[model samples]
Target chain A: MTVNVSVTVNGMRHEISGVEPRLLLSDFLRDTLGLTGTHVGCEHGVCGACTVLMDGHSVRSCLTLAVQANGSEITTVEGLGTPETLNVLQTQFREHHGLQCGFCTPGMLMTGEDLLRKYPLATDEEIREGLSGNLCRCTGYQNIVAAIRSAAALRRENA
Target chain B: MKPARFEYVAPASVDAAVETLLAANGEGKLLAGGQSLLPLLNFRMARPAVLVDLNGIKELSFIELRGESVVIGALTRHREIEHSPLIASRLPVMSAAMRHVAHLAIRNRGTIGGSLSHADPAAELPMMAMFYAARLTVQGPAGRRTIAAKDFFVDALTNCLEPEEIVVEIEFPIPQHDGWVFEEVARRFGDFALASIAVSIRRGQSGIEDARVAAMGVADTPLRLEDVERRLCEIEIDVRMPDRFCEWVRSSVSPNSDLHASGEYRKHLLGELARRALKTALAAKGDRR
Candidate 1:
């Protein structure tokens, strides 16, 4: 049966009707809303490629049903920054060459945003642990760790 | 992968949820957090005709101390337990095990009740629940009833709850032990443990007064090593105690081989992890003294 889903995405409210109860949040974001920046990898949720912010907390979109997010506020990769101006974490990712294929970049950026906002992230080990759910095979996670570490330092400096 | 088409209902109260499940006639699956259930749905391993969404039941999401017990609502998320100052101060072993649960993203949306209900043999929460001797309260069409953790888990990925029943909350008695430790070895930091151990010890004037030992990923279900606990209390605390306990633990469980690790390897891990956990708990007790 189709269900009505109303959600606020990146501060913009979208009311979608006739959404299948089985539609995943990942598909809803990508196909329905045209926010393809949120990548879907390993739809079983082992890969963090579908990570997004649900009410300021990072959650696996693939594991979340679209109907489940009816009243929630979601933040996808598209919400982070634009081509003209990148957010701090996005800038650090670009500088450190965090993405080799860019398939896992969106998930990494979203998870990084969640970590930078909440954690002290004083150590590289902490950043690595925070990024454990999101896998990156191309760079072997060295540059991703570097980028997040840099962003964490910048956050500390600004605070 | 996507789930098969199913009807969805968001019930606002426990009564409503129970009623929905009853009306579905065992075809309804309770959805909490959606961390474990969603994965099952995505794989189409579980095809329930009705998905009863319990997230709207705000009353089921809570962590509070009532009387001598720390009662945690079934809907309480792992991340909430991880960051709770109350859990840190009271059930410190649980606080420590939270890190070994899934990654931060999964933990944020995963509920303790869902984890316990999922009853994954390798998952950390089931092991913790057994370690704490938690009691689960389940509500059905008949009414609410309580089940001890030992009796609650029937098998891997299975609980004793009837299809129409839902776990309302888990009540853990505040431990009065002198020391506690949770040790796990996962291939990756956030992966399911190969074999993990949890130990809690209470010291008396003479020696170890009481000991609680449990292990995961080594059997059909999370196991409480009563024989090992008895042996631990019988032996004197020394450097060799871990070695002795390791041998006891190795002999206690017959783990099955899987792609992650062999049964023999898991047995070895159970031994070593038990040794390390026991030693750490003893040392913590020593420091307290």
Candidate 2:
């Protein structure tokens, strides 16, 4: 059956109709909306590659049905700053070499953003703990943790 | 892997949700947090014909106090419970266990009622609920009924709930235990527990007033340490008292051998965990929550 959904995506409201009831929010963002920044690595929820913001809280878009996201606010990795003007987290990721193959970069950035905004990430262990949900095959989590550490410091100074 | 094609409805009210569940009969699944159910659906492990979403039922998203019990709605998310001041003040053991349920994202969408109803053998909340003397309220076409935590869970991924019954609320009795402790050992952070111990102790001026213990992951269902609890309550607690009860705790549980851990190993771990948790609880007498 078709499920109609209207979601405010990345600040822009998209009134889309005829979505399948089983269509994952990640698939909708990638295939339907052509905003492919949200990756679907495991399809299952184990890998955090599908992380996105639902009402400003990070949720697994792959596990979330598009119909369930109806009338909700969603923020994918694309919602952050563009390549020319990278967001602070994105810039820190680049500076710390947080990506080798980059399959998990989007999820890492999204989770890092949520952690920076909501938590007092004071130590490397705390940043690593905040990032436990997201999985990175490359970089061994050391660089990703380093990037989040840098972003947390920058966030503090700017605050 | 994608979920099977199914009709989805988000009922705006609890009564409507219960009605929808009745209409779908045994083929309906209630979607509360969607953290666990969605994974099961995607793997095709659960193929419900219809999903009755409870997200729109705002009334099922509250945490309130009634007398000495904390009444939590069916849709109360784990993240909310973990950070709730009421839960922190009243049932800190459950709150402490919520951190080990999953990471932030999973906990953000996972619900207490959903987790308890899902009834995974390795989950934290179910065992903690049993240890804390909680009750689960379920509403069906017939009417609403409350089930004690001891009788609610039946087996792994199964409960005593009827097919058409929707779990509406969980009432956790705020026991004035002097100290409480929930310690779990997972393969990795946020993974299901291999074997965990939850302990609650109340010490009077003379001796140990009361004690409760429960375990998870080692058995097909969450288990209460009736023998261990009884043995411990009979004696005056000391630093050496908890370690002496280790043998009773190990013998009381019948753990099954699995790929992750052997039954013998689980027994050994449970004994150690019991000793540690008991000692910690005894040491932190009259601790908050």
Instruction: For every candidate, give the share of true A-B contacts it also has.
Output: 0.82, 0.65
Clashing pairs in 1: none
Tens digits of lDDT, candidate 1, A1-159 = 688999999999999999998999999999999999999999999989999999999999999999889999999989998999999989999999999999999999999999887788999988888999998879999999999999988888887
* TM-scores of all predicted structures: 0.97, 0.96
The model with the greatest TM-score is 1
Total clashing residue pairs per candidate?
Answer: 0, 1
> What 10-residue stretch in candidate 1 chain B is worst by lDDT?
B280-289
lDDT of each: 0.90, 0.86
Docking quality tier of model 1: medium
* lDDT by residue (tens digit), candidate 2, B128-225: 87888789999988889999999998889889988888888999888787688888888877889999888887888867778788889888888887
Cα lDDT of model 1 by residue, B38-139, tens digit: 988999999999999999999999999998889999999999998998988788888888988899999999999999999999998898889889999999
